[model samples]
Target: MTLASTGTVIEVETRAGRVRGAWRGTPGEGGASAAFLGIPFAEPPVGDLRFAAPMPKRPWEGTLDALEYAPTAQRGDPGVTLIPEPSIPGDSTLNVNVFTPAPGKTTALPVLVYIHGGGYFAGSPASPWYDGAAFNRDGVVTVSISYRLGFDGFGWIEDAPLNRGVLDWMLALEWVRDNIAAFGGDPARVTIAGQSAGGGAVLTLLGMPAAQPLFEAVYCISGAAADVSVDEAEAFGRRLAEAGGVTPDRAGLSSLSEERVLELQKQLTAPAEGGNPLDGLRQFVDGGLTLGPVIDGDLVPLKTVDAIRSGIGADKPLVLGATDDEFSMILSEAKDKLRWIPSRYLLGKVGLTGKARSAYVAANRTVAKKGTAAIVGRYLTDRMFRTLALRIIHARGEAPTWLYRFSWTSPTFGMAVHCIDVPFFFDCLAADKVDAIAGDHPPQSLADAVHAGAVNFITTGDPGWPRYTAASGETRVYDDPSTVIRDGYAEVASLLPS
Candidate 1:
C-alpha cells in the first residue's frame, strides 16, 4: 500500500455521493490507509436551516471533497482551545471523520464511532488529540464525528423541536450504518463512545428509541445519563431567542447569521458559578420553545435511567466511568469561590452539610500545598463525576455494566484529569500532543494497560474487568498501576442525597 498525505486522495462512496479523502500511514507501515475528513452527514443548518431538526443530505451527482474538517458547530470554539475554521462548507455543522487501514478494501472490521465533547457548546472532531492513527494500526476502523453545539444544536424554540444536537448525532449514526461497511467496518459491531458531553451523548443515544440497533455497545467517560428537564431546556432557549432578538421559531431564527447565533449561544451558555460549562450547559427538557424529547408523549417519553432500569437496551453491554480528578480543569476558578462561597457553589447551600462541609473544609486544609485549588477540584470532581457514576452503578439494573475509574495521573496534571484517558483508549496516545498539556510523558506501561482494556471491550463486549452489580459493587481503578477496587468509593456515592 502506498503511504500518502494531503497530496494523495482516495474516493469513498456515501449515501449522498462518492467523496474524496486524504491518505495517511499507520505506524510501522503495516498498510496504507485513507480517512474521509469533514464529510457532512446532514444538510448544512446555516441560513434557513438554523434550529431546524437535521435534514437529510440531498444526493449529490459525482464526487465531493472529504479531505478537510467542516466548520465546528455554530457556537465555534468551545472555550477550551483554538481550532481552525471548517475546511468544508455548509452550516448544519454535521460531519464525520473516518480512519481506515485499507481505505478501498471491503472488510467488516469492528467499528468505533466517536462523538466529541465540548460541553454541547464547543469542540470539534478536528481536535489534534482525536487523531485515529493508532486505532488504524490496531485493526479497528474509527470514525470521529462533529455535530451542532450550543443554541444551534440544542437550543429550543416554541416552534421547533428539542435536542437538535441529538438529532445530528442520530443522523451521523445513520450515515455510519449506511457507509461504514465500505470502510471495512461491521455495522453490527458498532461501539459508540465519547468523553464528557460526548459521554453524555452516548447515554442519550442509549435512551433514544431511534438510536436503537445502530450501536451494539456504548462506552462513556466522565458523563451521566440524566440532565435538565424539558422545561429547563425551553427556558434556556427562550433566553437565547431573546438575546438573539428573534422569535423562538425555526423560520424566524433561521434568518440570522451562523456567527450571530453562535455568539448568542456563547452568551447564554455561561456556566453557573462553581460549575463547569459541561455540567452547567444542558438541553432543557421544558415543554415549550424547547420542546425536546422529554417524558412527554413523544420522542423521549421515558427518563433514560428508567429506560435502562427496565431493560430497554439491556442486550447491549455498557462500559462507563470517570477520572479520579475529573474536575481539575475547573479548579482554576478564583480562590474566593473555592471556599464557603455558597452563592456560586454547584451543590448550592442546602446540599453542603455539617460533616460533609467539615470533610470538604478539612480536605481543603489538608491539601495545603495546592491551597483552595485543591478544595475546588475536590468539589467539582464529586459534583461532576463521582456521584453520577455511582448512581448509574447502583441504580437497579440487569444490563451488564462495567465501571472504571481513570486514576493515572499525568506528570503534568496528577491523576487522570477530565479528558486525559481518551487518547489512550483509541490507542493514539502519542499522536494527540496531550503530553504537552499533561505536562509530561505518560508511562508506556500505563498506555499498554489502558489500551488493552479498551481493545478487550471492543472485541469481547467485556472490558476485562468485573461487572458492576448493585449487590457486588465492583469497580476497576486505572492508575499508573491498575487494580480492581471493589466498592472503593461507595461512601462518596452514598453522600449524594437520594
Candidate 2:
C-alpha cells in the first residue's frame, strides 16, 4: 500500500493491478475510512461476452482509478426505489466498491459484502444505504457488489449462459478472496448479506454446494426468494424473445438492444391489460421471480428451501427476518376503498377462502382490525417473506440461526413496509430520503439496536439473540424498545398448510 503526496490518495496492489482510492473523512478520525469504487472483478460483459458468463478481469497496465462509483446494471431509473440506487452509464458494470478503515495495515478485519435487491431485474450497488462507511467505522471492512440484472443477466437462451447474475456473484466473491486482503479485509472471515432480491441472492448462495467456501455468515433482511425452475425461466425467455421479434437463443436475443429487452420485460411482467388489481397480489403468491437463477441441476441444483432442508449451509450462522408489514404500503391507496369490501371477500381474491380464510383472519385478529387492505397486504408479506423465514428456520433444525423482526412502523408510511428495515440495518439513518418514510424524527436508538446486532453477527457469528429452534422459535423484534419473544411468527403459522 502507498499514499500519494497530499495523503488523500491511497493505493493498494491487487492481483489485477494497483488501484487508487480516496479518504472519506479526516485521516485520524474514528469514523474515517477509504473508499475504492468501481473496481472490476470481471471483464466487461459486452460484445462477445454479452450473454455469456463473466470472464475474470485481466491485469491492467497502470494504476486504475477506482475513485468514482461505477456504471450499474440498473439502467434508467424508475423514479427511485425504496433505496436511492443510481444507475450510472457504462459497460464495465460488473464491479465492487470497497470501504475500509485500515488500507495498508494488514489487520485482516472481518468483512461484510452486501448485495442489492430489485427483484432480480433492477438494482444498483451504488445506493447510499449500501455504502460501507458505517461498517468500516466499526472496524469491519465492507464491499458492495454489482451483478448483471434482468434478461441480459438471467434469461435462458440456447447459447447464452443461465444465471449470469449468479455467476457474477461467485466471481465477485472470488475477487474478495483474492484481493480484499489488500484493503485490510480477511479473506476467510467474510459475511455476505442482501435485502429484497439481494436477500434472496444470499439465501440462494447459502444453499449452493459450490458456494460453501465463499463466506461464513448471512443476514437476510426482508428476503423474497426466487427459485425459478429451468422450465419456467425458458418459458419466460422464449416469450421475451418473441416480443422482440427474435429467436430465443443467445445470438438472436443479444441482437436486441438492452433498452428494448427491458421494455419487453416490463410488457410481459405487467399485469394483464384488463385484469383486476388483486391479480398483482396473486402473481407474487403463485409466481416466483420470472428471471433469476434456474434449477439447472449444475450451478443451482434445487429450490432454496429444499436445499436448506438438505443441509447445504448448516454450519454457517444465519440471521433472517422481515418487517411487521413488508408490502402493506403497496395497498395504502386502496385502504378507504377496500374498507367497503368484506375482508373475507378480499381474502378470497388471493385464494384464501372457506374455513381457511376464516381461520387465518381469526388467528390474525389484531391485523384484521386494521381493515381489509391491511389483511390482504399482511397476507402478501406473509406469503412471500415472513412465512418463508419460518420455513428456513425449521429446515435448519439445529443450525445456529437467529431471527429478528423489524417492527418499527414508519411514521410517514404508517407500517414497517418494504425496504424500511434496510437503513436501520446499515445504520445509515442520515442518508438521502430517509425522512420521506421515517418522518422527521426517525429513531436513531432503534438503528443503534438493529445495527449493533448486525455488526455482532458479522464479527462474531452470533447476533446477541437467542437461536431459533423448532421447540421454541425465539425472535428479536426491533422496535423503539426492541425485545425478544418466543414464537414471534405464531400468527403467521395459520398460513401454513395442514
- Which one is best on lDDT? 2
Candidate 1 stretches with Cα past 4 Å from truth are: 1-8, 26-31, 74-78, 81-92, 224-226, 271-297, 332-350, 355-372
Please provide, for model 2 over 209-264, each residue's C-alpha lDDT reduced to its tens digit, 9 standing for 90 to 100: 99989999998988888898888988898899888999998778878998898899
TM agreement with the true structure for every prediction? 0.85, 0.97
Query: Deviation in angstroms for 304 in model 1?
Result: 3.1
Q: Which pairs clash (backbone N, Cα, C closer than 3 Å) in model 2?
A: none
Q: Estimate the overall C-alpha local distance difference test score of candidate 1.
A: 0.68
Error of 2 at 452 (Å): 0.6
lDDT per prediction?
0.68, 0.88
Candidate 2 lDDT score at position 63 = 98
- 272 in model 1: Cα distance from truth in Å? 8.3
What is candidate 1's lDDT per residue for 447-491, written digit by digit as tens?
677777776787679889889877777888887688997775564
Candidate 2 Cα RMSD after full superposition onto the native fold (Å)? 2.4
